[model samples]
Target: MNTSTPSRHRRATRHIRAVIQILSTAMLGILLLLNITPLLAYAQSETDVTELGVVKLANALEEGKITSVEAVQEYLDRIKAYDKKIGDKPGLNAIVTLNQHALEEAAELDKERASGHIRGPLHGIPVLVKDNINTADMPTSQGNQALATYQPKQDATAVQRLKYAGAIVLGKTNMAEFAMFWDTVSSVNGRTYNPYDPTKNINGSSGGTGAAIAASLAAIGLGTESCGSITDVSSFTNLVGFRPTVGLGSMAGVDYNPLGDAIGPLALSVEDAAMLLDVLAGTDPKDPWTSEADSHKSDSYLASLKGSTLKGARIGYVIAPFGGYDYSPGPESDGIFSTTEDAISVLEAQGATVVKIPLNRSWWNKYAPQNASFWATTGHENFFVRTEATWPKGLAELTEPKDAINFGDIVKGSPKMEKTAVEWVMGDDKQPRDEAGFTAAVNARHTFAQGVDELFTSYKLDALAYPTVAAPPAKVHENPGELLDSEQFGTHCGWANFTGRPVVSVPVGFADHFPVGLSMLGSQFGDVKLLGFAYNLEQAAPHRKTPELTPSLLHTAGSTGTTASSDPSTGSDEASSGNAPFTSSSGMSPSAVALSLAAVLAAAIVLISLFVRRRKK
Candidate 1:
């Protein structure tokens, strides 16, 4: 080989060779970064944006790895991408009216953070409130067209509390029209499809929240439960739902029976739910029911998450919760009832004792509340008049559940209102309501709850365990036929509602590719302790799978995170494969990252060229 070049050109040749080597190394580094850097950032930032539970999201925001605006924008992007109908079929349809000021609110929160004024863990976090909960900024439609234009005079007490903690109100979600049915069909927003499978029902009235949060449209959400709205919807979507003991929080601005409907959190994990409950559970002067909140509440529900485990816990397995059906949940199907039997080993592995309390259909049938009549709108005369007073004269109608929006106008406007809505609103409100029916219903609930308490005592149990839903959620429907008759929303959930006890529903596993949930019920105001126990089960066997249909919209070319897999390994704090651990690293756009690398390489080439020119000179 020719070893030597002319001495005159030798220095220039060496410089040119050095430039080639540098170019090669830099190109390789860029290629590596194109794969590694973007992925790492996506794995951390964009993935976290779309999939992180509230606790992780808050940490990221506080650490400055993610700005509130970025988080809010990511959610807005998801809603735009997946929250509408696609290919003639309904999409998640989770969100209704998005807060126009969401970005501004986020920017302000970011400013507050930069100025070193952190409100709390919820500071700068985005959340979706159920539409029925009044938001001063957005119309509180309550999922009815008549009230679609009705702007609330003030935020719901809960909304005010959330904002005070520096949480951004992302938007309101759809519900069963007037919250009268188990399915999330509304006159205004129409039907909310399950993100897990768009063909299925989301189980109202917090169904919109269920779909949105499941789809990662927001970090966490608020839900209202008159019966199984929170737990069942959460069950279908494979999220953790906490139905706080009635009066644990105020129901003042919510558009449902104050005596029956309780507002709660629907979140990705037990920790997030507890953190939200920490901010939300307190006394409100507007709600007389919440007078006992100060007395019964813990100092911080988030604190309850510390070092929680199932060790030394006793759980009662109530069998008859699913009554009067050909459905006998044995060791056969892998649904909640069946898989819950599988949880025994998981529970026992975590040092918990499980007892089977086999109360048959007869016992359950006997305790059923007679006047738990779905039609009765008892105790709502004041609410009706109040709503009618706010209604515009042009939209005048029968001043009945009356006040802000006239029911006559509501019925006429919502010509497509579900039959269940028609029956509950018109049949009861228009007719002579039996006031005693409500009283008897309340008394019956007391009797049922007392019996369950006795059962808990007999079993020496810390909590009573049952399926969140009696069966898997039914399909979405045009006719109210099977939707009304179905026990899919959970027949046993009323036991807690009537007795005013707390229940936390966690995703246990999947049956037939759908999530099956296990609910743990604690004594009234025993919410904190029950939460810890539920957290243990969640740790033992996490079944949180991000829905396939509504995946992260991180990039046009590829996916951000893999779907969550059920890790049957017990006693591990790690979430599934899809959920990456939280990190304090911000993400740059792919184009920005690419351009930055290009500029660096270009600078190196320029420097080499100058050296060669000097050598030649």
Candidate 2:
């Protein structure tokens, strides 16, 4: 009698289990669909390729969605639209000379890609190098009209490396005349204005690259630094400027002082900068300073760009370097200090332990000024000798210049050179030309480096953070020399140059409508770690903003037959290759998103199957 009742109960239980299984499977399917919608939307979104980093660009190139020629042309179109004067609005005079064969070169790279011979991450990417860094195709003007026609017979070591890695040399960017001034005013290219604000100056001598990069004139740029040149210009222009350890990259084709000169990247993002560095860093026979680069260089700087790089890292904040109301109290200084504090908080939130580490102000005061003077003199001497030795005879034969043949000649030819020459001559007179004073300055720098090392060792720090330039950029009309009167000018950045350490300047926030930069200084040969740390900070709080005046071109893919609108007020047409595999603003590539969706679907299927089986039991 109980058997019949049990049979009926068993059948009822089986029916209930079947219903539950069906509901669970349906719910799982709905959840999977909901989860993948955003991913699909991201994959289909229209993203401007001009805003892409090196990795994305490379992936696009590999995927055959876009050709190198198209990318190069897009950059060229952007330059044409906004680089020069447009109507009454002052243009960003960032580029000195356009590469005459850029398109042809890009076509060749496209051919290479088609042949399945990929060079590296930089393959087919366009790059802008500062005028001082020699390129075989363009003149190494050093921003002096005197050398406007002086092309080098061979590429600079860094340039050669970039090219070997399949990067196209887009052009040379303008810089201070002979890289002599902080403001990027030149005898050849005139001046470079800030992309963020036309009325403001793009601090130099890397200002040209900074402005160009900020405005998306090129994919990325190469900038050389002596003292605050790289950091200053990058900070003011809201870019990521990396000045690697002096010996990290070759200075063969660059006209820089051996003591403090470095060539690094100015990019829209930290990862791109790191990619550039990965290609640039290594020993070069022409650059004796890089004799140890092979040993010091990382296998891949880009590999270190993890978002968790800041986790468990110790970062020391040096307040003296960031001059604010505490030292030179004022509205501007207060604003800078406030911005810096906010930046430190962001770092702390990103898992970094921030601690205030007071630098030896007396040590900085005693040597920073003298070191600046010393490097300026020695750097000029090196520049003069190097230029005269390496000047391209063919180009010199073709075009005769009115200005002097060398720095010495330039000093006699132009009044602009007078002040700098006097400084050089007086510096030599005071220190006997790289002898007593030079040695003293070097020792002072070594001491400073030791102090920094000790601080890091004691705290087990990953990096030292500060405002790249103590104060905001001086106005366009403000003389850099005059700005030095504020006591904060160059104080924070000069020490990095003097000590030959790696420092990266990244946009922190805004101050009075202008961009403010936070600098991260690392030990010698610590370029990768420094870049990683900066990348982490950048990913956490992306402070870099695209300038309103130089908005992203609507035709960033160059597939559109029509060019970008010349009028700044009107945006360009939707990107020409909108149908091409998309990359989201968050930098997730279409392929990556697809893969993620596939994985999620698989996991969901497994969960649904498990639920269905359990209910059926």
Candidate 3:
């Protein structure tokens, strides 16, 4: 029967099976390694859509290098990953409500692009709107718990324009409740931390937008400024903020002070801000204040961008605003002053004349007091009435405490609101609301406007430059309301608002780990010129730096994201970090690592297969 031969055959079969099993194990390992490579590379290739400026994103879309859906998804993923909470790192509570239909809208826009119908420069760009700005698709909570469910019937004029330009509404960002304070904290969303330093507060009422844009949660943001909300937040977050002349942009559908408020853009660069302004600046039938917008409008704000815009231009360095003589400097004064001086030097090198001018102390003292009184008394009453009338129907009828809907009730409901109310009342020396004071305040504004005109004429100045905030951003307080600055009116930003002049705040540099912004103030309706000058300075100095805490999550080829680079030539470090590709902690980007792993896996698989065949033969 040959039993020995049969046993030998069985042993031979077992050995062959064992070899096959070992080869299979090796192949699986190789396959796993190979799979990981592409995954890693794909991750590395994932673009941080946040870093792309409006124009750059538009160009990419036009070139079919990216899709609106991909861009929108990246922002959504970033928001989901870091908006509410990042890993151990303090979360930026920037967004209050994300547009549920963002992806769908983006898909539609992408389809439109495929059909050869481009909306505009902002087509398919995702933007964040300050919660205080009305949005039909999202609740206009104004970062107030009481108004948490309140949704507007229509979008704000600015939002409408953004949508008209094919810009996707990513979401509404948190803001000061009722747009009442400077710090971006509210009863609904808690507080938004500074992207650069979590311990510091993001100046509001546009603080959420500032933080969101700084963190790259959205491509650009829309902020409504009453006082220095826009500029202060921008200054603190190292962004470029534009506050147009009071009436240049519509205040319709936005909570604002008719005399002081304006809607503008907060962006990573001056050019992007200008592009937004180009779309947003126009006459609005709903906002009578914009009646003169057509006359004030330029052919194209984007066209005004030129390196030569600053050449032969006269810029006034208003020292008093930055604590030159009258006001004392804060602890961060040296750093602030140094960066400001450096900015001035950059302007000088750009062939612009920089003059040291003293702020009109006498004028500010005499009229500013009356204006303050008026703003607190008659001005407050007017704003309160208007806001009440325009408040969401649900908010307007709220009566939990029988008077919860009124401004006084809302103020008394919370200690923070009460404190802000006290400051507002005491700000004007507790002056009683009177027609005489109101008239006087109205006259003061006109007088201040005239004075601004006179100063520019006398100095032959193109713009007045000063620190956006008197000091660096104040540290965030345990009591969010405690972070509100009562002395904001004494700063340069308030003066610009009072006179209804257009102002642009550009990040100059970092001082004491906090960003310092330089503001350029121009005559009323001189927004185009202001933007042009800002563009020139931005190109020359380029001071905007991406916050370290909110670095890009993915590496992409030729991403024009800002980085901290020290270049002696520009006297600033806001430019690119050079042509070298970005790398992750692994020394290679995820994509590069994946490709290397893929090659290794292929070689390993080939070798294993060859060995197995040779052994089998």
The candidate with the higher TM-score, 1 or 2, is: 1
Pairwise lDDT winner, candidates 1 and 3: 1
Model 2, span 500-567: residue lDDT tens: 88999887777676778889898889887788889888776776656656654443233423222122
lDDT of 3 at 86: 67
- TM, every model: 0.81, 0.75, 0.81
Best by lDDT: 1
* Candidates' C-alpha lDDT: 0.74, 0.70, 0.73
Off by over 4 Å in 3: 1-46, 322-326, 366-404, 408-438, 486-490, 556-564, 567-617
Worst 10 residues of 1 by lDDT: 575-584
Report backbone clashes per prediction.
Answer: 9, 0, 2
Worst 10 residues of 2 by lDDT: 561-570
